[model samples]
Target: MPSKSPTPGLKRRRSGIYWCATHQAVQAGFRPSVARLPYSLENPDHRPLIEANCQRLQAEMLQFLANGGREQPRRYDGTIQSLSGLYQIDAASPFRRLKHNSRLKDTYVLKLIEAAFGKRALSALRIADFYRWYDEIKKPKRPGGPERVRRAWGVIKKLRELFAYGVMAELPECERLYTILRHARFAQPARRRMVMRLAHVEAFIPQALAMGRLSLALGTALQFETALRQKDVIGEWEPIPAGAKRGADDFVLNGRRWVRGLTWADLPADLVIRKATTKTGAFAAHDLKLCPLVLDLLERIPSEKRTGPLIIDEVAGRPYAESAYGREWRIVARAAGIPNQVWNMDARAGAITEAEDAGADLDHIRSAAAHSQAATTQRYSRGAVGKSRRVAEMRLAYRGLRNGP
Candidate 1:
């Protein structure tokens, strides 16, 4: 038999939402699930917060059973830590809407904020305090390394969101912090200059195929030719929802599912991929028929092997985990005599660069890459001299035409 909960009227779910069972009965004896408390059960400090919420729910249930009205608003203490906890747990907060990897990075910064000034009064914080904090966190250059500000910038960005959440919730301190920090300036990291060219892809594919890693070669061609993000090409691992039925295409690892990648089903007889991107939820359509590289690689795979994920680890016979995918790609890249500085991620950038260099329309590049803005696509079009050379030629020709030379 399974053990009973020591805490009544509350159950902790595998996904970490604190499920509250305390609720008043409605018509037909149906009781709705009231809340999913965001407090961490593992954090010893959150125990009191958990108990308080549970007690509040039970009290509300009793009051509803007696008189049948709405539950009262829960009051939050105005501390940085308290606000941080609320921001994390609030369903309507932007924090909840972030992609999984982004959520993890943002949470790390939030934890740092909580540890540093968690107990401090939010209203007491000023511009000077943030300036000092930023300076303290930023790393100065050592003998061999450049100065680091990216981490500091990330912290400030997350902190701003935290303050914004508080303001949205109508907290006074957050309003003050938001108002004061409007004028503060922070340094941003330099843009990346490195990009993998089609030459690199051409070299990598043959080397990867020579080493019997057909999946790596195929994914490389897809990213370079189609401008698909690495995640969109290989998919991601996510915890399986409880009681979820497994599908034929589903790749299971322990209790998790490998989802949202280029399944064989995505490619029909038309050879055009039409699917919503995982990050932006925007539709990106790429015609594989236009990509001779992808076509040639596809022909190399045996017919039976083309049934599941387009990029599969042959040894595991499953989709590659993000880290494993990088590791294997690095091994093949090294064997191909690719530089250590060149990354598999650069394939998308390389594609954008190639398009820009070829004088393709900016809007067309943005559409193909599934970018919402041309500015975003512009960022990926890195270090191309072809566009500049074309511009120079056009200017000289115009001068010649004007001067009758």
Candidate 2:
């Protein structure tokens, strides 16, 4: 069995956060599960905050419990160190429930945060401090500066996202810091992720397939037609249920969901592609447009084949793997004279961009793109990224008569 009583005091460590030994002892005596213990976490920088927060806080906690008090929210005076400790204790707290995967990510990012400001008072660091840290990340002597900045920016973004007054309100100073950080841009020189362009769809992949790289071309072709993610390409499909609110012609493919992707048995009767969710922080479901090209591709699937990846690598005897899919794409792309920068995954981005550019109804794009919210399509942009670099010229033709050409 664990020690029933810990030494009575509050201590701060390099990783920040102060601990109350007395409160811990009290909790151990109370028989609360690890997830339930009311941790007396505080912060006093690298020094001790209280020689014995254990005695006083422990007494207060016990008295409250004895008086039939509800579960006290784990909190501490606002300090980065204290906030860090509270973060751990409250991880399993009811008010701030986090899924296992999300908690794991929080833990990893917390490590980076603790290393930088664990022992410091969370308020001691100003918003400018974070900005300065981002600056250092951007100018790192080593290579991969862009990636480093991106990762660090992600940490800050998560911090803002996770800051909730209702869940963990003890960190006033931390809250203030987040509020300040929110107003500022944390990263610079926006990094552009290249995707396919809309206008090139007609000639791109047909040229690739003509070059005789079947698997890669087919994989690219399927993504182009359906706007399905790479994982969905090899995942299952199934029709919507009989009693649900769907058209008789409407079908739902076995979708890649939050936790798992679908398989062969999930194939639906019709060609509706409904990805229950997407990994890209949004969701999408699109009825395959009845365009001739799209229908032609679907028709190619053997009628007897009721399930499995819509696109396949028959040579592998399983779904086409992502690596092989990308590798073959590069081969096909090179011979087809496609630019090296365009990615196999860019098809979805290209399709969404095209759908928006073509003035497809907003709801149509939203359903097709699986946007988590309707307004998400507002960022759905198109046209060349290089338009600014090109010469600007405008020629307006009047309704009936124009200047001689």
Candidate 3:
């Protein structure tokens, strides 16, 4: 006789435990307790175990019928895991509105939350539970490694976001838990003060070019000189939507399309670039003629070669993935004697700092950096003392004028 088909919502695992496929959770009290028990349902020796599992399944099925055959699709049992599932997958979720990169990161953090406290009911959670998880997650993943305080902080931040979503979704107990944790404080990692200088960029360029990485060199120079982010300089690969029309500019690879970076088209005229930034949608226009070093680097690329993306990974003929760009940039940076602390991303900060030192107007610097706020530009203008010196000079001049110098 042909083997019997499993029920619609349940399947037998290799360990002989029947899992509720629809619920994505094991059926309650259905797991085997004995070690190394024989799991063959066809064998007479395994009949007792099989019958017991079936009895549990039958009871649950009758209960489902008794309740008018309706159950929440994911069977929300008032657990954080169920709430997280709804938050992540529900069409009405705010999570769906997050940026592509943010969604990817939050998804990873959500997994950590699920693994740590998935089964815990929202009502049972206390603020102390969050602190305890914080202390544990901040510990190094590997023995003797540096403490993962940053990673732990990131998890806490995502958890807070999850709770906020739960409140919006109006899930049971979520609003209460969210209210209790409203004043909670978690540990934060120290602010990053590392910055890359023009000298580092200059050295990085020659070394990158020597290593046959023209794209890396161009990208580094663009970020430093134009105060553009790495994403705006090199673009990002996003998944191509199904049945979407592929345009001439679309770079399709493995079902993903690269979009929204500097292109030759953005530089409509020689020695000039005009483009809206990706993150803030701020318009950023720069005359390459004003950026001598950037001009020099641009000159090295022949006119014909500048037809497409200004930064293309020579090896793959595609724009560099963020991580790949960082890895390769490090090798060239290390060879150029740039300290490890000075990350590739610090190029924008370095540009802002340099502008501040050069006594550029705060608003002008903010515009060039495409920052929506002057405070954001000030934050990036780290280690520049010119502003203080300028303040002192103005005060002295005012006193002299009053005293008739």
- Candidate 1 vs 2: which has more lDDT: 1
Best-to-worst ranking by lDDT: 1, 3, 2
lDDT per residue for candidate 2 within 1-405, as digits (tens), equals: 222334233343322233332444444443121111112244223122232233334544564455565434545755554565565555344324654335535655655565666667655777777777776655654575335666668667655644543135544665676677778776554544566764455556577558654445555655666566766665422222223465443223221112224343434556555555435645555454554555555565566764644555556554543246677667767676778888777887777666665656667767776666667654544453332322232233342246664
- Per-model TM-score, in order, reads 0.78, 0.55, 0.79
State each model's CA lDDT, in order.
0.78, 0.52, 0.75
Q: Which lDDT tens digits does candidate 3 get at residues 1-405?
A: 211433223344432334232222223322121112124556654454444334434444445444555432345679977788778656678887877667756765776677678889987888889889889999987799988999899987877777888888777888877776678887799877988898999899999989998888888988998999999988986655535799886677534578888887787667678888989898998988788777777778887787777788888787775467888899999999999999999999999999999999999999999899999999898899878989999999999999993
Q: Give the best candidate by lDDT.
A: 1
Candidate 2: list runs displaced more than 4 Å. 1-108, 140-149, 162-169, 185-193, 198-219, 229-269, 279-305, 309-340, 356-359, 372-375, 384-405
Candidate 3 residue-wise lDDT at 216: 86
Lowest lDDT 10-mer window, candidate 3? Answer: 29-38
What does the lDDT come to for candidate 2?
0.52
